[model samples]
Target: MIVTISDNNKNKTIEIKEKKLISTILSESGFSFSMPCGGKHICGKCKVFAKGNLSEPSLKEQSLLQHESKSDIRFACMTYVLGDTEIKLINKETEILTDGYFSQYDLNPSGINYGFAVDIGTTTVAVYGYDLKEGILMCKDSFLNPQSIYGTDVISRIQSSIDGNSKELQNVISDKIQKSILRLCDEYQININLVDNIVITGNTTMLYLLLNKNVRPLASAPFLIDDFLGRDVTASQCGFTHLNNANIYLPRTMSSFIGSDITCSVLAARDLIDDSKSTLLVDIGTNGEMTLFHNNQMLCCSTAAGPAFEGVGITMGVMAESGAINKVYLENNNIMYTTIKDKKPIGICGSGLVDSLAVFLSLGYIDESGYINIDKGEYITEYNGKHAISISDSGNSITQADVRAAQLAKAAICAGIYSLLNEVSLKPSDVDRLIIAGGFGSYIDVKNAAIIRMIPEELATKSIVVGNAAGAGASMILLSEKCRIENEETAKKAEIVDLSTSPYFMEKFVDCIMF
Candidate 1:
């Protein structure tokens, strides 16, 4: 059968087999769609308009439609293609953030031939191919984590795994990585056969799920992990036959919450950690994982910042992709904004969301208590059937709930930072270097972040953006045995703190809810 997709006044035709859902057909046609609930008929972000022979909407879809109060709209994921159809996507295309902060270090790659350094994040995956013998990065690629269809956070993903979706999660991630490796090889004019090793870094749950390990241990109290130190396996064992001989190595984890991603990030910022300067390295996203080094001791903590910082669970929120608003500023009482790749604004990203809140707070459109002055109705717009302040003239907006989401996220992150400092008996001023690492960290305006009090104003001057520190650290390990050894030692020395159980954590988190 054939399916015609209408997007932005442009129509494209796609061919599909019988019994395929519109969501599956659009995915096969290379059209980007957000499946925040992982195609489970929940969250209801994957909306499309279909006019043709198609199966009836399921009870779930019907209920969702009624709740949305939109009769013409349908859930693409819930609608099956019974015959030829035309589908108009109501959801905007989402882009993934590939840029991040990585600390620069000396490398000696003469001992190695070729390898891959992969940073498997909850929302996105980044891979860097290195020609180790020449000490040069050959190619890099990144994409949205396909597992997002199941849910946006690690907990939801863990639930999916516990619900007997381990193989699906494993296959989706593995397939994406394998395909990325192949494309990287082809792009760099290098043969896949010459690649000798692959080093991967991710949070504990991500690495666990990628290998199809049980996640029940991570879901409840007394959380335990099967492997803190990842195992050595062949590419074939992970189902990648193209590099059958390649050694797939995953870095060790610090705790159930603190995974190899933090370990590798620590490796990237190794030089920045010394007695002369107390350093804090924070990779901000769904989980705001931070590591602080002072007097040769390392303290690590993970905060449940939620998916809001990554643009999930917000009305008109999107990932850091093309057409996503990445910046917002006020000029002569007029709002000025910029989007990623200079594309037309579709929605706000994590950085953009931060910028919007900061700008709104500065302009008095929003109150200190996170209230939007209803008197400023000129700046308020309707969004998803609710009132939201206009962040873009193109009808893109930030709702009160969006602000609340940001508040919850920033409160967790700031509280974690505060508790870490309190534990060390140091002030924000004591931090000589505050290295911001991760995709969100890369694009966020440090000034705006401080303005919103998401980050303490005291550290504004010391804050440094290091793009893709985890990926670069993975690359460093791939190129130099020294980096690998140092990371192992750092993992051993680093200590993990469970903030959820801390007595002072709840009090601090509540205190940080206001600007």
Candidate 2:
């Protein structure tokens, strides 16, 4: 069987000897397709347009596809190609957040030639190439994390690893990063052999998967880890055969859930970690990792915020990409919105989701309890058998279930903030700065975020949008040996707060769920 895959107008044909899932064919063909639910027939997001010689949709696939308007659309994971088929992949141009702010540091290169700093995020991976001789950044690139095919969240990926996909996960990400680095070198007319040092940072599970370590620890209670990993290994050891001369340094992880990404974030935002005043640093994504620094003490916790904020789980959600609604507001007593690049609205992203919830609350379309009153507004319409607020003329809408998903996600973040504050015996007003770190955090409207109660309104004015601080921190670690030492020390000072066992967290979680 021959499968013709079309992505962004590019066509690639692959030969398959036997019938196989479209997802499998795509994966084997080196295409980036997200199966957030690990191909368990959940998420319903792996939609692709297919024609000719495909298996009939399963009952589960049919039910999931009911909300989809196009009859030709099929779930890539659920659909099988028995013969020659043409598949049009719905591959969006992702708007990855790469630029970040890092404090000035002394130049101290670990190697003589080129160096690369990588921030391996759950949803995306950013690579920064630098000139070790001149101590300047030469190039940078980012892509959707290929491991997303296994799942979207860290837990999901961990579960995938536990299901014996560890080697596969490691290979996909390793190969992607290696290729990304080589591409950067080729694009900039640099020698790949000269890339002598690489600094990589991510959550514990991400690093574990990168190293192909056992992930069963992260899947259960106690969440113990064998290797804390603030050490260096050869690129060849990490399967980066292209950069055989490079030494890959994995930053130290604070806890099983709170990974090196937070460590690097703190290092990047070191100025905010002042001793005189309290500061809270939050990287809100699939895992809501937060750090509170006050009086020389650091308290960190990880909350399972799920993938709602990243536009997963929501009825009509997407990554921050072209055509994605990235912002929403009220104009002339009417709901108004904007998409990335002013493209046609496909669905809402995290920032837009926050703004939408705030708009809905202010307009009284959503009650204090988060009920979407369909009778309250003309935009309210039924979608997938639930009340949804239409966001676009093309029929894209935020369903009631999406509101609940947003509530749960925001509540997890807000509750985690409160829990940290309660631990430090400080109120929201006491925090001098609420440093919002990460790609999603950088684009969000602080006012809308506070309006939705995702963060304390008091801290809204104090909020600092530090874009991609983790990547910046990773870059710092790559450029400075002192920064690397600080990264390790910062990890040591953090005291992990297990929210799963905290009654206060539970109490705050319940309260924050009210929106």
List residue ranges in candidate 1 displaced over 4 A.
1-33, 40-42, 47-51, 56-74, 85-111
User: TM-score: which candidate is best?
Assistant: 2
What is candidate 1's lDDT per residue for 1-515, written digit by digit as tens?
77889877557897766788777776665554567766776566777888788889888887777755455677878988888888887745455455554556567642357888899988878888888777777788887777776678899899989988888778778888988899888888878888888998999998888888778889997887767865576675565646775788888888899999988888887666666778998988899999988887799999999888667777777778678888899899788899988998877888899989998998888998899886785687776677789975856888888899899999998889988887889899889989998888877888888888777888889988777788878877777777777788888888777898987778888888888
Candidate 2 C-alpha lDDT tens digits along 253-314: 99999999999999999976678889999998888999999998999999999999788888
Error of 1 at 368 (Å): 1.4
Cα displacement (Å) at residue 508, model 2 = 0.3
lDDT of each: 0.81, 0.89
- RMSD of candidates 1 onward, in order: 3.6, 1.4
**TM-score on alpha carbons, each prediction:** 0.89, 0.97
Q: Using alpha carbons, what is the TM-score of model 2?
A: 0.97
